[model samples]
Target: MTAGFFEAPRAAEFALRNVRVPATLAPGAVAPATQDGHLDVDIAIASGRIADIVPAGTIDVARGPDLRRSVVWPTFADVHTHLDKGHIWPRAANPDGTFFGALTTVMADRQANWNAADIEARFDFALRCAYAHGVSAVRTHLDSFSPQAEISWPVFAKLRDRWEGRIALQASSILAMDPFATGEGDRLADLVARHGGQLGCVTRLAGEDHVGVPANFDDYMTRVFELAEARGLDLDLHVDESGDPEARTMIRIARMAAKRKFKGAILMGHCCSLAVQPDEAIEATLAACAEARIDVVSLPMCNMYLQGREGGRTPRWRGVTLLHEMKARGMRVAVAGDNVRDPFYAYGDHDMLETFVQAVRILQLDHPMGDWPQAATTTPADIMKLPATGRIARGNPADLIVMRARSHSELLSRRQSDRVVLRDGMAIDTTLPDYRELDAIVGMK
Candidate 1:
């Protein structure tokens, strides 16, 4: 709490009464936020779930925490993240800041120091950043390029237990689908099952430029589906992350998933190529996604960091998925914090609201107030399969955040970092990661 926040007279009002919260920030909301008027409501929590919603001044609030003219909203959930490779940007720095450069630098660093201890430290740092910024859940894409997952899995499972009910931690294997031939594919699926994580893949069905058709593409995806079907695990893929218009693997995957009627939830991250496709093609792809019940995870931060640099000339299109079209088609789309201060994206604090702001700007997702907040809240929580998450209704879990900003515009500004995070009605004392001195480790690189 900030200084002078706990005035003795208004101690009761500070918690649940006299708070002018925006009426719109909730799951499945699409209404524009009206600036002139705010709602006065008192929220009551009991046993971790919302006990009641009464008019302000009606509820007894002698025990309310000091909100300091803050707005209360559902805590955020990051649908996509790369945790195993997080917080190593200095050691994984690439002068060019290109996508390929990130891969090269991070792979080299990982092969050197990505043991259980190192990975756990970096992962802990990233999670702390998330917790401090009102994120209660995250789906991290673990580094699964090798058998290292067998080692990393135990560490993540332990943290999942450690942060239980506070921050729901879900993980997936981010690996190439081509290695199924070497029998490593089975091992990866088994690893995910053993840890109860999702099966993930970076589906590279196209070449570097990715403007032309891919050879033996379906064969690769067949193996991916086979593994998912065998293990009954959900599928999350890195699909069509390239900027090329012809990198249309997202469409193919959607059609295939719909046809196969895959049982588990299917999620796709970074459908950046869909932006360049023709309107007809894009609409068809979105329709297929809707039919397959696929959740499109838009990662504005990493895509903005990596895309359009190699084109030399000022790039015409930003690296982003078609959020407007997808939303118009009634498809499920949520924004996420993809990579946090890793080789892929060199800027982040594991703040999902930061990602929400980036998506609002880069994707021009000027969705009405209630709708935009849902991207980070209810929508992603549903995609994460978190049952009691992402809403502030009666009987919903009291996983919430109180920020020093009251208006929707103030929320987007992201200027207020002083806030209280609550899980099941208890305040959390959060710590931030320090990253000041990296000269000895990263200066030489």
Candidate 2:
């Protein structure tokens, strides 16, 4: 009930009675029914760290207790998102729904009103939305190509420092071409490093006029990587975001990282090219990615909206990366809400549950390993390298969301709502919203 109760590294205890969990914690497995259709589990939180999890009935509920009865799971972590562009904008709709059109809209709107106050307000609203939806950690992209990085990057840093107890923040310096040229590479990297941010690049910059300088894709990427290494920062590149079959930038980056022995810190987002690549190429690329330990983050919602409609075909491209194949190859794959309600994506409620549902349906992961929801929820946590979060086990972070659905199929089929959300063993919002509304939105019964 107190604000400090949920802060990190504080020892608080909680009990959840009558909860069902999946049978296996492996990649993809069906969550089994509870033996008694109820579980009495006790969660111990200390110093904002999950200290222990014990049988609920083992502890006496009468003595100084923080307890609740509902399904509990780890807090969600979004490995990729553009937090600075979280607000909705009024602009010419993309009739063609092409990636280029979306990019143009974003560019126009960003140029129109991208300032420190505007960017901070949007990011603050986004962080609040993420917290209300039970997302405790996120890696957000800040467009460094815009001179606004001088304003936005500091806002993100301040927010991260202020909310360290509630969220873990990672700022990605977006190296995509904007108002800046390739000549600004060293300065940009220095700027990001000055603010404790990481390096990010977009392999393909959209536009024609900038083609001579910053438009040089190969040179830009090489410079970004070189600067990243020089600054001792990690890389998260938007490699081949379009559906172009010829875009093999991710493959090249993978090979380069492997050759340089890059320590598995790079994340390649929206490698949509991999979805359409030849089988041999896909295999080789996956192998190289695994060898280099490159992390792959697929943005289903944005990619589905922007790139899938190309060529005007029925049963449009799913716009999802080779998630299953990548998993099989032992590559770390995390799915994120890349853009939320912005020019690039007209939708995104900042709820990762929706993202999980899309993954299940688009990836046909109903029977992944054995359980669908568990895999859908847990895999992303592992991919994001979140050790204290994601699984329902002893000593894990007490950040959890309790859903109304009884089974994985029920949860997925209904897109069930989180009935209760707890951060650090204390409930924040206990009101259980209707999942039926979401079901209707997704065309589910």
Candidate 3:
């Protein structure tokens, strides 16, 4: 009916009447049962928690805005992202839009300008975008190489405190595996533990391109596992992001996880090569992942941008992991917005709704639609270990995204840019930060 269809009342208790929510996201009983995988209910909010749910028209509509069967979703959780490297595209544009270009350009950019202040400014900006778009939790990978680790982790900790209630933040240290083989790995792991962060590294050695898995892959992976085990830290890694079929470290990491019985959780991002591997190989890897209890977050946006690019040829094959197969095997698979406005992705506003819409198209996550939306919401939240987030169940916080779209068709066909983001039963200001705000820092002049 309007640009922003729903507005919560100023009163503490209110009702959202005639709203439709995915049945999977809405837990507990209601007067009217779910139909076609969705539930049409009136949700009651008391003191910022979901108080009750009943069939639409069963509740008085005067308490709050009548949503007219609009689709409601819980606030999102982005489990894989690069906040420390976000919004640096102006000064550090990828030279050729290749993986190599992104890697080298970001390296130079980090070296030249990644002081605490610079990182804090950009990191806070990204968080603001995410919060406004209804993301309640995020796990960002910080570029943690030597001095950068010393610098970025502190900024992340500070931001974690600053954005506490509005947006839950988690950080992971990311660099090449070579550092993990040396003493520097121990130091970084210690820093991560100090900041309550995850220990992470790319599954490749230093100076190695995205070809085959590095020859020392096992040795370095062993070192990384040992470091995490010693510190009692979880692992979040950038694994096999390359389209090169030879870049098959994801399976190895999974196998190693099963062999070592690493105590903490493991979340591996971007396993792009798995899509290109033979079906048997793909199944085997996924089996290993399931056996190891490894959680996978596919960065579809960034993978599509970087995976199959060449200078003067039409690229083929979407660079995404075998999500359908993995899901069939009962593995926890999530889709996330990774590297927003950075060299690896080039574009994104830290918006999870957009990420889900694009993922639906990029990975063909539709046809049946089913519970696939969970990949961007409940599933990622589960992976991030934030159980309280990403679902609209009774007794949970009334953190929700109320959109004009009532069905999956309308939800996917158009971008819900004007969706209302409610945090604790109050609508937050969804205004995105202006890019000009970083003109000076990013050298946009």
Candidate 4:
């Protein structure tokens, strides 16, 4: 029944000694105290909360097993994901693996299937996978186009209640901007507010004209901002999720937020086009984003699979946003698991650790690793407004992931399947759901 590298002590009071923890997670560790971005510490747990943390040998050596410098991380928070659209690749595989292919396949699947029960089954499965992987919180984007919104939002509410104590769940509405220009945005906003969810949409309008930002982009953007502001709800948007160098809606959104004095938090995801813009444009956009206090989350795995993709050509650039530039400008940036086994991305397990690993390589977050690990843990937790979800402090719940990987080199080199996930200082099962369980539901005979 034990599934971790080591089992947590059965007693309510104990300590884990000689563990390496990210310095950023340990509020007490100063820059000078870190050994290459990590600090060796002994953590004492009592009654399901972190009791104390001090230098490696501060606790009696016999109090706990020597972790031998194993890296211990705060359990993760995935701030941007598509739970309603996850795990559809089984029956609705993308024909060409292009952006349009994913869009069309997901739309078709939504129409043909996607009833409440069907969605609840798949969404619950994804959450189970996330919980088992040590994710303490998640914010998912629901496909809120007309009836789909009606169907998906209720299911999300039910699951949110069901998984309340296990994983903190938040949902945001996702659709094209055209709805906001019309009156559908108001209707959707009402539904979102009733369910205590965020108002969101993609910047692109709904039509055959698949060019850059729409000519009426500002008009619709105004509506969306007004809608969110009126209801005191946050905004989570899909911005410029393409490689077309001209897709520059991100800067416009940031500027609009500042101009309107929008008080609610705004989180923009999948800003892939920023990477291809001119240097001046990039700097201007980043400055605007910083001034507006906009948070950015890059979906590296999904962007890589969908962007710069043509039938038979090599992808010249990695399809991620300017994470380093944005971070350097004092903006909060995060990495998240966007789609899991869906048409948009054919592979993911709802594992934020895996997302961070892939992001480190895709965004070149190494060179020092620095505080990049926060992108998955603290950064996303802050974005999701869950202060206690992804932190390792004396008064916080002892929800943590302990891995045998002593250094970043070892952490990133292997999958870390044997890692231990502790919730309330107790080890829970890490077994993933059987894929065969979905065979019947997905029609995968």
Among the numbered candidates, top lDDT falls to: 4
* Higher-TM-score candidate of 1 and 3: 3
TM-score of each: 0.90, 0.82, 0.97, 0.98
Mind giving the per-residue lDDT tens digits that candidate 1 earns over 1-445? Answer: 3322222222212245545455544433222334533455666667666676555666565746434445677788898998888778767776687777777787788788788877777787778789877789988988786767777888899889988866899999887656765588898889899998999887673123344335677887878888999989999998877777888888788888878888888899998888888889887888888888788988998998888876456656678888777877787789999887778898888887778888888887664544666787878988887756766666777667766677767767864566666667666655465654333433334
Per-model lDDT:
0.74, 0.66, 0.88, 0.90
> Which scores greater on lDDT, model 2 or model 4?
4
Q: TM-score order of candidates, best first?
A: 4, 3, 1, 2
Q: Which prediction has more favorable TM-score, 1 or 2?
A: 1
lDDT of 3 by residue, 383-411 (tens): 88888899888899999999999888888
Tens-digit per-residue lDDT, 159-221, candidate 4: 999998889999999998888877788899999999999999987876332357788889999
Which 10 consecutive positions of candidate 4 have the poorest summed lDDT?
27-36
Candidate 4 TM-score, true structure as reference: 0.98
Specify the poorest-scoring 10-residue window by lDDT in model 1. 4-13
